[model samples]
Target: MASEFELIARHFTPVVSGSRTGVCLGVGDDCALLTPRAGQRLAISVDTSVVNVHFPADAPPEAIGHRALAVSLSDLAAMGAEARWCLMALAIADADDDWLASFARGFHELCAATGTTLVGGDVTRGELAIGVTVMGEVPSGQALTRDGARPGDVLAVTGALGAGAGGLALWQRGERDMAHPLLMRYLRPQPRLEAGRGLLDLASAAIDVSDGLLADLGHVLKASGVGARMEVDSVPMAAGLVEALGPDAARRAALGGGDDYELLVSLPPDAMDEAVRRLASQGLALTPIGRVTADPGLAGVGEIGPHGWQHFHGGAS
Candidate 1:
Protein backbone atom coordinates (compact mmCIF):
# COMPACT_ATOMS: atom_id res chain seq x y z
CA MET A 1 0.00 0.00 0.00
CA ALA A 2 1.31 3.42 -0.87
CA SER A 3 1.42 6.13 1.77
CA GLU A 4 -0.30 9.44 0.95
CA PHE A 5 2.93 11.23 0.16
CA GLU A 6 4.11 8.37 -2.01
CA LEU A 7 0.80 8.40 -3.86
CA ILE A 8 1.02 12.11 -4.56
CA ALA A 9 4.67 11.92 -5.59
CA ARG A 10 4.18 9.08 -8.03
CA HIS A 11 0.91 10.21 -9.56
CA PHE A 12 0.38 13.93 -8.91
CA THR A 13 3.57 15.96 -8.55
CA PRO A 14 4.91 15.47 -12.06
CA VAL A 15 1.72 16.80 -13.61
CA VAL A 16 1.85 20.01 -11.58
CA SER A 17 5.15 21.11 -13.10
CA GLY A 18 3.85 23.09 -16.03
CA SER A 19 3.33 26.88 -16.14
CA ARG A 20 5.21 29.22 -13.79
CA THR A 21 2.67 31.93 -14.62
CA GLY A 22 1.29 33.19 -11.30
CA VAL A 23 2.47 30.37 -9.09
CA CYS A 24 5.16 31.53 -6.68
CA LEU A 25 5.39 27.98 -5.40
CA GLY A 26 3.41 24.90 -6.46
CA VAL A 27 2.93 21.43 -4.99
CA GLY A 28 5.38 19.84 -2.51
CA ASP A 29 5.31 22.90 -0.25
CA ASP A 30 3.79 23.64 3.16
CA CYS A 31 1.21 25.62 1.19
CA ALA A 32 0.96 26.53 -2.46
CA LEU A 33 1.88 30.19 -3.03
CA LEU A 34 0.46 32.46 -5.72
CA THR A 35 0.66 36.03 -6.93
CA PRO A 36 -2.05 37.59 -9.03
CA ARG A 37 -0.98 39.70 -11.99
CA ALA A 38 -1.15 43.45 -11.81
CA GLY A 39 -4.77 44.72 -12.03
CA GLN A 40 -6.21 41.21 -11.85
CA ARG A 41 -8.41 39.66 -9.15
CA LEU A 42 -8.45 35.99 -8.27
CA ALA A 43 -11.71 34.13 -8.76
CA ILE A 44 -11.72 31.07 -6.54
CA SER A 45 -14.35 28.37 -6.23
CA VAL A 46 -14.50 24.85 -4.81
CA ASP A 47 -16.70 21.90 -5.77
CA THR A 48 -17.03 18.42 -4.35
CA SER A 49 -18.21 15.09 -5.72
CA VAL A 50 -19.10 12.05 -3.62
CA VAL A 51 -19.39 8.44 -4.63
CA ASN A 52 -22.96 7.28 -5.33
CA VAL A 53 -24.20 10.80 -4.62
CA HIS A 54 -22.56 12.86 -7.34
CA PHE A 55 -21.48 9.88 -9.41
CA PRO A 56 -21.96 6.16 -9.48
CA ALA A 57 -19.63 4.23 -7.19
CA ASP A 58 -18.62 2.03 -10.10
CA ALA A 59 -17.92 4.87 -12.51
CA PRO A 60 -14.55 4.94 -14.30
CA PRO A 61 -11.93 6.60 -12.11
CA GLU A 62 -10.78 8.74 -15.02
CA ALA A 63 -14.23 10.20 -15.51
CA ILE A 64 -14.56 10.84 -11.79
CA GLY A 65 -11.28 12.72 -11.74
CA HIS A 66 -12.17 14.83 -14.76
CA ARG A 67 -15.59 15.75 -13.39
CA ALA A 68 -14.26 16.72 -9.97
CA LEU A 69 -12.09 19.48 -11.38
CA ALA A 70 -14.29 20.30 -14.34
CA VAL A 71 -17.17 21.33 -12.11
CA SER A 72 -14.99 23.70 -10.14
CA LEU A 73 -13.55 25.23 -13.28
CA SER A 74 -17.05 25.95 -14.51
CA ASP A 75 -17.37 28.52 -11.74
CA LEU A 76 -14.29 30.31 -13.01
CA ALA A 77 -15.75 30.17 -16.51
CA ALA A 78 -18.92 31.89 -15.30
CA MET A 79 -16.84 34.71 -13.89
CA GLY A 80 -14.91 35.04 -17.15
CA ALA A 81 -11.71 34.15 -15.38
CA GLU A 82 -8.62 32.65 -16.96
CA ALA A 83 -7.55 29.34 -15.51
CA ARG A 84 -4.41 29.51 -13.38
CA TRP A 85 -4.23 27.15 -10.39
CA CYS A 86 -6.08 24.35 -8.64
CA LEU A 87 -5.79 22.35 -5.41
CA MET A 88 -7.34 18.96 -4.97
CA ALA A 89 -8.24 16.93 -1.87
CA LEU A 90 -9.11 13.27 -2.08
CA ALA A 91 -10.72 10.83 0.36
CA ILE A 92 -10.68 7.20 -0.60
CA ALA A 93 -10.95 3.84 1.12
CA ASP A 94 -7.59 2.69 -0.17
CA ALA A 95 -4.58 3.90 -2.14
CA ASP A 96 -5.20 1.87 -5.25
CA ASP A 97 -2.17 2.62 -7.39
CA ASP A 98 -3.68 1.96 -10.81
CA TRP A 99 -6.79 3.91 -9.96
CA LEU A 100 -4.77 6.82 -8.67
CA ALA A 101 -2.64 6.91 -11.79
CA SER A 102 -5.66 6.84 -14.07
CA PHE A 103 -7.31 9.54 -12.00
CA ALA A 104 -4.23 11.67 -12.20
CA ARG A 105 -4.14 11.26 -15.95
CA GLY A 106 -7.69 12.45 -16.24
CA PHE A 107 -7.18 15.38 -13.87
CA HIS A 108 -3.94 16.48 -15.47
CA GLU A 109 -5.28 16.17 -19.00
CA LEU A 110 -7.69 19.04 -18.42
CA CYS A 111 -5.14 21.05 -16.49
CA ALA A 112 -2.72 20.78 -19.36
CA ALA A 113 -5.35 21.54 -21.95
CA THR A 114 -6.56 24.63 -20.08
CA GLY A 115 -3.14 25.82 -18.92
CA THR A 116 -4.18 25.44 -15.27
CA THR A 117 -1.58 24.25 -12.78
CA LEU A 118 -2.20 21.83 -9.97
CA VAL A 119 -1.01 23.65 -6.87
CA GLY A 120 -1.50 21.42 -3.83
CA GLY A 121 -4.04 19.22 -2.05
CA ASP A 122 -4.52 16.46 0.53
CA VAL A 123 -5.29 12.78 0.44
CA THR A 124 -6.73 10.69 3.26
CA ARG A 125 -8.50 7.46 4.08
CA GLY A 126 -12.22 7.89 4.07
CA GLU A 127 -15.32 7.51 1.93
CA LEU A 128 -14.85 8.11 -1.78
CA ALA A 129 -14.91 11.86 -2.42
CA ILE A 130 -12.97 14.47 -4.42
CA GLY A 131 -12.93 18.19 -3.79
CA VAL A 132 -11.18 20.77 -5.91
CA THR A 133 -10.50 24.44 -5.33
CA VAL A 134 -9.74 26.23 -8.58
CA MET A 135 -8.35 29.74 -8.91
CA GLY A 136 -8.35 31.99 -11.94
CA GLU A 137 -7.40 35.57 -12.66
CA VAL A 138 -9.77 38.14 -14.08
CA PRO A 139 -9.17 41.82 -14.71
CA SER A 140 -10.16 43.86 -11.70
CA GLY A 141 -13.80 45.07 -11.87
CA GLN A 142 -14.42 43.00 -15.02
CA ALA A 143 -15.43 39.62 -13.68
CA LEU A 144 -18.92 38.57 -14.68
CA THR A 145 -21.59 38.06 -12.02
CA ARG A 146 -25.22 37.04 -11.75
CA ASP A 147 -26.23 40.44 -10.40
CA GLY A 148 -25.29 42.47 -13.47
CA ALA A 149 -28.28 41.49 -15.57
CA ARG A 150 -30.88 44.16 -16.18
CA PRO A 151 -34.26 44.74 -17.77
CA GLY A 152 -34.27 44.56 -21.59
CA ASP A 153 -31.16 42.38 -21.63
CA VAL A 154 -31.24 39.29 -23.77
CA LEU A 155 -30.69 35.92 -22.12
CA ALA A 156 -28.54 33.59 -24.20
CA VAL A 157 -26.88 30.22 -23.75
CA THR A 158 -23.74 28.77 -25.21
CA GLY A 159 -24.40 25.46 -26.91
CA ALA A 160 -27.34 23.10 -26.42
CA LEU A 161 -28.73 21.74 -23.12
CA GLY A 162 -30.19 18.57 -21.50
CA ALA A 163 -27.40 16.31 -22.75
CA GLY A 164 -25.93 15.66 -19.31
CA ALA A 165 -29.26 14.78 -17.80
CA GLY A 166 -30.15 12.77 -20.85
CA GLY A 167 -26.87 10.95 -20.49
CA LEU A 168 -27.64 10.13 -16.89
CA ALA A 169 -31.00 8.74 -17.92
CA LEU A 170 -29.35 6.48 -20.47
CA TRP A 171 -26.79 5.33 -17.94
CA GLN A 172 -29.51 4.51 -15.44
CA ARG A 173 -31.08 2.29 -18.07
CA GLY A 174 -27.91 0.15 -18.13
CA GLU A 175 -26.70 1.52 -21.40
CA ARG A 176 -22.90 1.63 -21.35
CA ASP A 177 -22.14 2.81 -24.85
CA MET A 178 -19.23 5.15 -24.25
CA ALA A 179 -19.40 6.44 -27.80
CA HIS A 180 -22.90 7.76 -27.32
CA PRO A 181 -22.84 11.57 -27.25
CA LEU A 182 -25.40 11.86 -24.51
CA LEU A 183 -23.68 9.18 -22.41
CA MET A 184 -20.34 10.94 -22.71
CA ARG A 185 -22.07 14.15 -21.77
CA TYR A 186 -22.89 12.64 -18.39
CA LEU A 187 -19.33 11.42 -17.93
CA ARG A 188 -17.36 14.36 -19.33
CA PRO A 189 -18.81 17.85 -19.44
CA GLN A 190 -16.70 20.52 -21.16
CA PRO A 191 -16.71 23.86 -19.43
CA ARG A 192 -17.15 26.85 -21.76
CA LEU A 193 -13.90 28.55 -20.83
CA GLU A 194 -13.05 30.32 -24.08
CA ALA A 195 -16.61 31.28 -24.83
CA GLY A 196 -16.96 32.74 -21.35
CA ARG A 197 -13.88 34.90 -21.78
CA GLY A 198 -15.26 36.12 -25.07
CA LEU A 199 -18.37 37.26 -23.23
CA LEU A 200 -16.50 39.15 -20.52
CA ASP A 201 -17.05 42.57 -22.01
CA LEU A 202 -20.24 41.61 -23.84
CA ALA A 203 -22.45 39.96 -21.24
CA SER A 204 -23.92 42.03 -18.48
CA ALA A 205 -24.04 38.92 -16.29
CA ALA A 206 -23.34 35.23 -16.71
CA ILE A 207 -23.75 31.88 -14.99
CA ASP A 208 -22.75 28.36 -15.85
CA VAL A 209 -25.66 25.97 -16.16
CA SER A 210 -24.87 23.26 -13.64
CA ASP A 211 -28.43 23.39 -12.48
CA GLY A 212 -31.19 23.33 -15.10
CA LEU A 213 -31.47 26.35 -17.39
CA LEU A 214 -34.69 27.72 -15.93
CA ALA A 215 -33.54 27.23 -12.34
CA ASP A 216 -30.13 28.79 -12.92
CA LEU A 217 -31.67 31.61 -14.92
CA GLY A 218 -33.81 32.37 -11.90
CA HIS A 219 -30.67 33.22 -9.96
CA VAL A 220 -29.72 35.85 -12.53
CA LEU A 221 -33.25 37.18 -12.46
CA LYS A 222 -33.40 37.52 -8.71
CA ALA A 223 -29.95 39.01 -8.45
CA SER A 224 -30.60 41.51 -11.20
CA GLY A 225 -33.96 42.47 -9.70
CA VAL A 226 -35.80 41.57 -12.85
CA GLY A 227 -37.91 38.90 -14.52
CA ALA A 228 -37.77 36.95 -17.76
CA ARG A 229 -39.87 35.80 -20.70
CA MET A 230 -38.61 32.69 -22.41
CA GLU A 231 -39.58 31.15 -25.70
CA VAL A 232 -39.28 27.45 -25.05
CA ASP A 233 -38.93 26.79 -28.75
CA SER A 234 -35.81 28.90 -28.80
CA VAL A 235 -34.02 27.00 -26.01
CA PRO A 236 -31.59 24.73 -27.79
CA MET A 237 -31.75 21.02 -27.02
CA ALA A 238 -28.73 18.80 -27.13
CA ALA A 239 -28.23 16.99 -30.40
CA GLY A 240 -30.09 13.66 -30.35
CA LEU A 241 -31.97 14.66 -27.21
CA VAL A 242 -35.34 14.66 -28.93
CA GLU A 243 -34.61 11.27 -30.48
CA ALA A 244 -33.50 9.78 -27.17
CA LEU A 245 -36.25 11.20 -24.97
CA GLY A 246 -38.90 12.43 -27.39
CA PRO A 247 -39.66 16.07 -28.03
CA ASP A 248 -41.68 16.74 -24.86
CA ALA A 249 -39.44 14.89 -22.43
CA ALA A 250 -36.39 16.29 -24.17
CA ARG A 251 -37.71 19.80 -23.83
CA ARG A 252 -38.40 19.21 -20.18
CA ALA A 253 -34.94 17.85 -19.61
CA ALA A 254 -33.38 20.75 -21.47
CA LEU A 255 -35.33 23.03 -19.18
CA GLY A 256 -34.45 21.34 -15.88
CA GLY A 257 -31.52 18.97 -16.43
CA GLY A 258 -28.32 19.73 -14.53
CA ASP A 259 -24.61 19.42 -15.43
CA ASP A 260 -24.90 21.24 -18.73
CA TYR A 261 -21.84 23.41 -17.94
CA GLU A 262 -22.78 25.88 -20.67
CA LEU A 263 -22.80 29.59 -20.00
CA LEU A 264 -26.08 31.45 -19.72
CA VAL A 265 -25.40 35.07 -20.44
CA SER A 266 -27.44 38.24 -20.22
CA LEU A 267 -26.59 41.05 -22.57
CA PRO A 268 -28.32 43.97 -24.17
CA PRO A 269 -30.50 43.17 -27.21
CA ASP A 270 -28.37 45.12 -29.63
CA ALA A 271 -25.28 43.22 -28.58
CA MET A 272 -26.78 39.83 -29.39
CA ASP A 273 -25.49 39.68 -32.95
CA GLU A 274 -21.95 40.56 -31.96
CA ALA A 275 -21.92 38.08 -29.09
CA VAL A 276 -23.21 35.30 -31.31
CA ARG A 277 -20.73 36.28 -34.00
CA ARG A 278 -17.84 36.18 -31.56
CA LEU A 279 -18.71 32.72 -30.25
CA ALA A 280 -19.44 31.49 -33.75
CA SER A 281 -15.89 32.30 -34.74
CA GLN A 282 -14.82 29.90 -32.06
CA GLY A 283 -17.16 27.30 -33.61
CA LEU A 284 -19.56 27.52 -30.67
CA ALA A 285 -23.22 28.48 -30.90
CA LEU A 286 -24.73 31.21 -28.76
CA THR A 287 -28.52 31.12 -28.80
CA PRO A 288 -30.81 33.78 -27.48
CA ILE A 289 -33.68 32.10 -25.64
CA GLY A 290 -35.35 34.91 -23.81
CA ARG A 291 -35.27 38.51 -22.65
CA VAL A 292 -35.09 40.07 -19.25
CA THR A 293 -38.04 42.10 -18.06
CA ALA A 294 -38.94 44.68 -15.44
CA ASP A 295 -41.58 42.36 -13.93
CA PRO A 296 -40.79 40.61 -10.67
CA GLY A 297 -41.00 36.95 -11.82
CA LEU A 298 -40.64 34.64 -14.74
CA ALA A 299 -43.25 34.36 -17.44
CA GLY A 300 -43.01 32.12 -20.43
CA VAL A 301 -44.86 30.96 -23.49
CA GLY A 302 -44.91 27.64 -25.37
CA GLU A 303 -44.14 24.64 -23.13
CA ILE A 304 -41.70 26.41 -20.86
CA GLY A 305 -41.70 25.30 -17.22
CA PRO A 306 -39.64 26.27 -14.20
CA HIS A 307 -37.57 23.34 -12.98
CA GLY A 308 -33.97 22.53 -12.03
CA TRP A 309 -31.66 20.63 -9.70
CA GLN A 310 -32.06 21.65 -6.06
CA HIS A 311 -29.80 19.58 -3.79
CA PHE A 312 -31.73 17.68 -1.05
CA HIS A 313 -34.99 19.20 -2.20
CA GLY A 314 -35.50 17.21 -5.39
CA GLY A 315 -33.31 15.37 -7.80
CA ALA A 316 -32.51 16.76 -11.26
CA SER A 317 -35.16 16.14 -13.88
Candidate 2:
Protein backbone atom coordinates (compact mmCIF):
# COMPACT_ATOMS: atom_id res chain seq x y z
CA MET A 1 0.00 0.00 0.00
CA ALA A 2 1.32 3.49 -0.80
CA SER A 3 1.63 6.00 1.99
CA GLU A 4 -0.29 9.30 1.65
CA PHE A 5 2.86 11.21 0.83
CA GLU A 6 3.85 8.63 -1.78
CA LEU A 7 0.41 8.71 -3.35
CA ILE A 8 0.45 12.49 -3.73
CA ALA A 9 4.01 12.59 -4.98
CA ARG A 10 3.33 10.03 -7.67
CA HIS A 11 0.00 11.33 -8.91
CA PHE A 12 -0.52 15.00 -8.02
CA THR A 13 2.77 16.77 -7.30
CA PRO A 14 3.83 16.80 -10.94
CA VAL A 15 0.73 18.77 -11.84
CA VAL A 16 1.72 21.69 -9.60
CA SER A 17 3.09 24.66 -11.46
CA GLY A 18 6.69 25.50 -10.49
CA SER A 19 6.36 28.82 -12.34
CA ARG A 20 7.68 30.85 -9.33
CA THR A 21 5.76 33.94 -10.43
CA GLY A 22 2.13 34.36 -9.26
CA VAL A 23 2.25 31.33 -7.00
CA CYS A 24 4.80 31.58 -4.19
CA LEU A 25 4.55 27.99 -3.05
CA GLY A 26 2.50 25.14 -4.52
CA VAL A 27 1.86 21.53 -3.49
CA GLY A 28 4.38 20.02 -0.97
CA ASP A 29 4.24 23.25 1.04
CA ASP A 30 2.23 23.43 4.25
CA CYS A 31 0.11 26.09 2.61
CA ALA A 32 -0.06 27.43 -0.92
CA LEU A 33 0.58 31.18 -1.42
CA LEU A 34 -0.69 33.47 -4.16
CA THR A 35 -0.54 37.10 -5.29
CA PRO A 36 -3.42 38.59 -7.22
CA ARG A 37 -2.73 40.92 -10.11
CA ALA A 38 -2.73 44.58 -9.21
CA GLY A 39 -6.08 46.31 -9.67
CA GLN A 40 -8.05 43.06 -9.80
CA ARG A 41 -10.47 41.39 -7.42
CA LEU A 42 -10.08 37.76 -6.48
CA ALA A 43 -13.05 35.46 -7.10
CA ILE A 44 -13.25 32.17 -5.22
CA SER A 45 -15.72 29.26 -5.05
CA VAL A 46 -15.86 25.77 -3.55
CA ASP A 47 -17.83 22.75 -4.81
CA THR A 48 -18.04 19.13 -3.79
CA SER A 49 -19.28 15.86 -5.31
CA VAL A 50 -20.09 12.64 -3.50
CA VAL A 51 -20.39 9.21 -5.06
CA ASN A 52 -23.97 7.98 -5.60
CA VAL A 53 -25.20 11.48 -4.83
CA HIS A 54 -23.57 13.71 -7.42
CA PHE A 55 -22.37 10.84 -9.59
CA PRO A 56 -22.84 7.12 -9.90
CA ALA A 57 -20.39 5.03 -7.93
CA ASP A 58 -19.61 3.12 -11.12
CA ALA A 59 -18.73 6.19 -13.16
CA PRO A 60 -15.32 6.37 -14.81
CA PRO A 61 -12.64 7.94 -12.62
CA GLU A 62 -11.66 10.38 -15.34
CA ALA A 63 -15.20 11.75 -15.63
CA ILE A 64 -15.37 12.22 -11.87
CA GLY A 65 -12.16 14.25 -11.90
CA HIS A 66 -13.29 16.38 -14.83
CA ARG A 67 -16.75 17.01 -13.35
CA ALA A 68 -15.47 18.05 -9.91
CA LEU A 69 -13.19 20.74 -11.35
CA ALA A 70 -15.58 21.78 -14.11
CA VAL A 71 -18.39 22.50 -11.63
CA SER A 72 -16.12 24.70 -9.51
CA LEU A 73 -14.75 26.58 -12.51
CA SER A 74 -18.29 27.32 -13.67
CA ASP A 75 -18.68 29.62 -10.70
CA LEU A 76 -15.65 31.65 -11.80
CA ALA A 77 -17.16 31.83 -15.26
CA ALA A 78 -20.46 33.15 -13.86
CA MET A 79 -18.49 36.01 -12.34
CA GLY A 80 -16.54 36.64 -15.54
CA ALA A 81 -13.24 35.79 -13.82
CA GLU A 82 -10.20 34.15 -15.35
CA ALA A 83 -9.50 30.82 -13.65
CA ARG A 84 -6.05 30.76 -12.04
CA TRP A 85 -5.63 28.24 -9.22
CA CYS A 86 -7.44 25.26 -7.73
CA LEU A 87 -7.00 22.97 -4.72
CA MET A 88 -8.63 19.58 -4.58
CA ALA A 89 -9.53 17.29 -1.66
CA LEU A 90 -10.16 13.66 -2.41
CA ALA A 91 -11.60 10.92 -0.25
CA ILE A 92 -11.22 7.44 -1.61
CA ALA A 93 -12.18 3.99 -0.39
CA ASP A 94 -8.86 2.49 -1.32
CA ALA A 95 -5.32 3.23 -2.52
CA ASP A 96 -6.03 2.30 -6.11
CA ASP A 97 -2.97 3.56 -7.97
CA ASP A 98 -4.36 3.17 -11.46
CA TRP A 99 -7.55 5.01 -10.61
CA LEU A 100 -5.60 7.79 -8.94
CA ALA A 101 -3.32 8.23 -11.93
CA SER A 102 -6.21 8.31 -14.38
CA PHE A 103 -8.04 10.90 -12.26
CA ALA A 104 -4.94 13.05 -12.08
CA ARG A 105 -4.54 12.88 -15.84
CA GLY A 106 -8.05 14.20 -16.37
CA PHE A 107 -7.67 16.96 -13.79
CA HIS A 108 -4.26 18.04 -15.00
CA GLU A 109 -5.33 18.00 -18.62
CA LEU A 110 -8.06 20.56 -17.87
CA CYS A 111 -5.68 22.67 -15.80
CA ALA A 112 -3.21 22.70 -18.65
CA ALA A 113 -5.86 23.61 -21.19
CA THR A 114 -7.20 26.45 -19.07
CA GLY A 115 -3.83 27.76 -17.83
CA THR A 116 -4.93 27.11 -14.25
CA THR A 117 -2.43 25.84 -11.71
CA LEU A 118 -2.90 23.10 -9.15
CA VAL A 119 -1.94 24.73 -5.89
CA GLY A 120 -2.39 22.34 -2.96
CA GLY A 121 -4.83 19.75 -1.66
CA ASP A 122 -5.33 16.77 0.65
CA VAL A 123 -6.25 13.12 0.37
CA THR A 124 -8.06 10.97 2.92
CA ARG A 125 -9.48 7.46 3.20
CA GLY A 126 -13.26 7.38 3.08
CA GLU A 127 -16.13 6.94 0.65
CA LEU A 128 -15.39 8.31 -2.81
CA ALA A 129 -15.71 12.09 -2.90
CA ILE A 130 -14.05 15.17 -4.41
CA GLY A 131 -14.07 18.82 -3.43
CA VAL A 132 -12.37 21.71 -5.13
CA THR A 133 -11.74 25.33 -4.23
CA VAL A 134 -11.06 27.47 -7.29
CA MET A 135 -9.71 31.01 -7.45
CA GLY A 136 -9.75 33.55 -10.25
CA GLU A 137 -9.40 37.29 -10.75
CA VAL A 138 -11.39 40.03 -12.45
CA PRO A 139 -10.73 43.74 -12.81
CA SER A 140 -11.82 45.66 -9.74
CA GLY A 141 -15.46 46.80 -9.94
CA GLN A 142 -15.95 44.91 -13.21
CA ALA A 143 -17.09 41.46 -12.08
CA LEU A 144 -20.62 40.68 -13.20
CA THR A 145 -23.25 39.76 -10.62
CA ARG A 146 -26.88 38.63 -10.51
CA ASP A 147 -28.00 42.02 -9.22
CA GLY A 148 -26.88 43.98 -12.26
CA ALA A 149 -29.80 42.84 -14.44
CA ARG A 150 -32.54 45.39 -15.10
CA PRO A 151 -35.86 45.80 -16.84
CA GLY A 152 -35.68 45.71 -20.64
CA ASP A 153 -32.49 43.64 -20.62
CA VAL A 154 -32.46 40.68 -22.96
CA LEU A 155 -31.96 37.21 -21.49
CA ALA A 156 -29.52 34.99 -23.37
CA VAL A 157 -27.70 31.69 -22.95
CA THR A 158 -24.23 30.77 -24.18
CA GLY A 159 -25.19 27.38 -25.63
CA ALA A 160 -27.92 24.75 -25.77
CA LEU A 161 -29.40 23.46 -22.51
CA GLY A 162 -30.58 20.11 -21.05
CA ALA A 163 -27.55 18.17 -22.31
CA GLY A 164 -26.15 17.39 -18.89
CA ALA A 165 -29.50 16.37 -17.50
CA GLY A 166 -30.33 14.44 -20.63
CA GLY A 167 -27.01 12.71 -20.29
CA LEU A 168 -27.77 11.80 -16.72
CA ALA A 169 -31.09 10.29 -17.81
CA LEU A 170 -29.38 8.16 -20.42
CA TRP A 171 -26.69 7.05 -17.98
CA GLN A 172 -29.29 6.09 -15.41
CA ARG A 173 -31.00 3.94 -17.99
CA GLY A 174 -27.92 1.66 -18.12
CA GLU A 175 -26.76 3.03 -21.44
CA ARG A 176 -22.96 3.06 -21.33
CA ASP A 177 -22.26 4.28 -24.82
CA MET A 178 -19.43 6.74 -24.19
CA ALA A 179 -19.77 8.11 -27.70
CA HIS A 180 -23.33 9.27 -27.21
CA PRO A 181 -23.42 13.05 -27.09
CA LEU A 182 -25.81 13.21 -24.15
CA LEU A 183 -23.82 10.68 -22.19
CA MET A 184 -20.61 12.57 -22.93
CA ARG A 185 -22.36 15.75 -21.88
CA TYR A 186 -23.32 14.22 -18.56
CA LEU A 187 -19.92 12.69 -18.03
CA ARG A 188 -17.62 15.50 -19.18
CA PRO A 189 -18.99 19.05 -19.21
CA GLN A 190 -16.96 21.89 -20.66
CA PRO A 191 -17.03 25.05 -18.57
CA ARG A 192 -17.53 28.26 -20.57
CA LEU A 193 -14.37 30.07 -19.50
CA GLU A 194 -13.70 32.12 -22.65
CA ALA A 195 -17.35 32.99 -23.14
CA GLY A 196 -17.49 34.30 -19.59
CA ARG A 197 -14.50 36.59 -20.11
CA GLY A 198 -16.02 37.88 -23.33
CA LEU A 199 -19.17 38.86 -21.46
CA LEU A 200 -17.30 40.92 -18.89
CA ASP A 201 -17.73 44.04 -20.99
CA LEU A 202 -21.25 43.44 -22.24
CA ALA A 203 -23.40 41.38 -19.91
CA SER A 204 -25.18 43.21 -17.12
CA ALA A 205 -25.69 40.03 -15.16
CA ALA A 206 -24.74 36.36 -15.59
CA ILE A 207 -25.13 32.93 -14.00
CA ASP A 208 -24.17 29.43 -15.07
CA VAL A 209 -27.10 27.04 -15.51
CA SER A 210 -26.15 24.30 -13.08
CA ASP A 211 -29.69 23.89 -11.85
CA GLY A 212 -32.02 24.32 -14.93
CA LEU A 213 -32.62 27.27 -17.22
CA LEU A 214 -35.90 28.50 -15.72
CA ALA A 215 -34.78 27.81 -12.18
CA ASP A 216 -31.43 29.54 -12.57
CA LEU A 217 -32.99 32.39 -14.51
CA GLY A 218 -35.36 32.86 -11.60
CA HIS A 219 -32.28 33.51 -9.48
CA VAL A 220 -31.16 36.41 -11.67
CA LEU A 221 -34.66 37.86 -11.63
CA LYS A 222 -34.87 37.70 -7.84
CA ALA A 223 -31.49 39.34 -7.35
CA SER A 224 -32.10 42.04 -9.93
CA GLY A 225 -35.52 42.90 -8.46
CA VAL A 226 -37.29 42.26 -11.73
CA GLY A 227 -39.41 39.71 -13.59
CA ALA A 228 -39.06 37.88 -16.88
CA ARG A 229 -41.15 36.67 -19.85
CA MET A 230 -39.47 33.85 -21.71
CA GLU A 231 -40.06 32.99 -25.31
CA VAL A 232 -40.13 29.29 -24.50
CA ASP A 233 -40.00 28.37 -28.17
CA SER A 234 -36.73 30.23 -28.49
CA VAL A 235 -35.00 28.44 -25.64
CA PRO A 236 -31.96 26.62 -27.01
CA MET A 237 -31.91 22.89 -26.25
CA ALA A 238 -29.27 20.22 -26.46
CA ALA A 239 -28.80 18.52 -29.82
CA GLY A 240 -30.98 15.42 -30.39
CA LEU A 241 -32.89 16.00 -27.14
CA VAL A 242 -36.23 16.30 -28.90
CA GLU A 243 -35.65 13.17 -30.92
CA ALA A 244 -34.67 11.19 -27.85
CA LEU A 245 -37.14 12.48 -25.29
CA GLY A 246 -39.86 13.86 -27.53
CA PRO A 247 -40.63 17.59 -27.84
CA ASP A 248 -42.55 18.06 -24.58
CA ALA A 249 -40.24 16.04 -22.35
CA ALA A 250 -37.18 17.57 -23.98
CA ARG A 251 -38.58 21.06 -23.49
CA ARG A 252 -39.34 20.21 -19.88
CA ALA A 253 -35.79 19.00 -19.35
CA ALA A 254 -34.34 22.02 -21.09
CA LEU A 255 -36.35 24.29 -18.84
CA GLY A 256 -35.86 22.52 -15.50
CA GLY A 257 -32.93 20.16 -15.89
CA GLY A 258 -29.81 20.76 -13.82
CA ASP A 259 -26.03 20.49 -14.43
CA ASP A 260 -25.85 22.27 -17.80
CA TYR A 261 -23.02 24.61 -16.65
CA GLU A 262 -23.82 26.96 -19.52
CA LEU A 263 -23.95 30.70 -18.91
CA LEU A 264 -27.32 32.45 -18.70
CA VAL A 265 -26.90 36.17 -19.15
CA SER A 266 -28.95 39.35 -19.15
CA LEU A 267 -27.80 42.33 -21.16
CA PRO A 268 -29.17 45.53 -22.62
CA PRO A 269 -31.29 45.12 -25.75
CA ASP A 270 -29.12 47.60 -27.64
CA ALA A 271 -25.99 45.57 -26.83
CA MET A 272 -27.46 42.21 -27.87
CA ASP A 273 -26.12 42.29 -31.44
CA GLU A 274 -22.60 43.18 -30.33
CA ALA A 275 -22.62 40.59 -27.56
CA VAL A 276 -23.74 37.91 -30.01
CA ARG A 277 -21.05 38.98 -32.47
CA ARG A 278 -18.33 38.95 -29.82
CA LEU A 279 -19.26 35.47 -28.62
CA ALA A 280 -19.57 34.23 -32.22
CA SER A 281 -16.02 35.38 -32.94
CA GLN A 282 -14.85 32.95 -30.28
CA GLY A 283 -16.75 30.03 -31.87
CA LEU A 284 -19.55 30.20 -29.28
CA ALA A 285 -23.17 31.16 -29.91
CA LEU A 286 -25.55 33.19 -27.75
CA THR A 287 -29.27 32.53 -28.09
CA PRO A 288 -31.87 35.02 -26.92
CA ILE A 289 -34.40 33.23 -24.67
CA GLY A 290 -36.40 36.03 -23.13
CA ARG A 291 -36.47 39.60 -21.81
CA VAL A 292 -36.43 41.08 -18.35
CA THR A 293 -39.55 42.86 -17.23
CA ALA A 294 -40.61 45.24 -14.43
CA ASP A 295 -42.95 42.67 -12.88
CA PRO A 296 -42.00 40.59 -9.82
CA GLY A 297 -41.38 36.97 -10.85
CA LEU A 298 -40.87 34.54 -13.70
CA ALA A 299 -43.89 34.71 -16.01
CA GLY A 300 -44.36 32.44 -18.99
CA VAL A 301 -41.94 29.77 -17.87
CA GLY A 302 -43.12 29.89 -14.27
CA GLU A 303 -46.72 29.22 -15.29
CA ILE A 304 -45.56 25.80 -16.45
CA GLY A 305 -45.36 23.15 -13.72
CA PRO A 306 -42.18 21.91 -12.00
CA HIS A 307 -39.38 24.53 -12.28
CA GLY A 308 -35.64 24.12 -11.48
CA TRP A 309 -33.75 21.65 -9.24
CA GLN A 310 -33.64 21.69 -5.47
CA HIS A 311 -31.51 19.44 -3.29
CA PHE A 312 -34.18 18.24 -0.83
CA HIS A 313 -37.52 18.83 -2.47
CA GLY A 314 -39.04 15.61 -1.12
CA GLY A 315 -38.35 12.58 1.06
CA ALA A 316 -35.69 10.20 -0.26
CA SER A 317 -36.91 8.67 -3.49
| Candidate 2 per-residue lDDT over residues 199-274, each given as its tens digit | 9999999999887787788889889999998898998889978877889778877887778889999999998999
Tell me which residue pairs clash in candidate 2: none
Candidate 1 lDDT, tens digit per residue, 47-158? 8888877777777788888888888899999999999989899888875778888888889998887888888898887898899999999999999999999899999999
Find the 10 residues in a row with the least total lDDT in model 2.
Answer: 308-317
Q: Model 1 clash tally?
A: 0
Error of 1 at 252 (Å): 1.5
Candidate 1 has a TM-score of: 0.94
lDDT of 1: 0.85
Q: Give candidate 1 regions above 4 Å deviation.
A: 1-5, 15-19, 301-317
